[model samples]
Target: MHTTHHCKARQSQRGISLKMVNYVLTHGALENDKIVLGKKEAMQRLADLEREKRLLMKIADKGGVVVVADGEALITTYNCSHRN
Candidate 1:
């Protein structure tokens, strides 16, 4: 049981790390091997992260795929039907 719990915790940490990497790669500016964001932009990004997280949680509760857009300051969600 202890080993199973540890494995689950490790998987959760990996997921979080992946999310951070994705966010950085999409939005962060890489300068001299360092990821950087401007003061105002950083604050705005934090707000956007919270908003996106809440949205993702709601969607996950309904068993929906998590969809995210580019890291621009604008937050937009599209509702379109897929045609098979």
Candidate 2:
């Protein structure tokens, strides 16, 4: 997550947030040492998330609440009827 001064300047100029850079790092395909998230890869990742959301929705419809946590800290909670 470390950014060089030049990188920070370019990011400001390009309006690319650190969050977006992290997303590309996490999900992007590796080319040599660089990570690249092209349009196709981005679309595929979004589609995969959508499929997971649908599955979670089905469970929620069955009166299940999906709780996502990190260790003991709750990250998110959701159901078909409500979200927290």
Clashes of each: 0, 0
Give one digit per residue, the lDDT tens place, for model 2 in 4-37: 9999999999999999999998988899989999
Question: Can you give the lDDT of residue 64 in candidate 1?
Answer: 62
Query: Candidate 1, which segments miss by more than 4 Å at Cα?
Result: 1-36, 65-84
Residue 63 lDDT in model 2?
77
| Best by the lDDT measure | 2
| Candidate 1 local lDDT, 38-80, one digit each (tens) | 6787799889999999998876666564345677654555433
TM-score of each model, in listed order:
0.36, 0.72
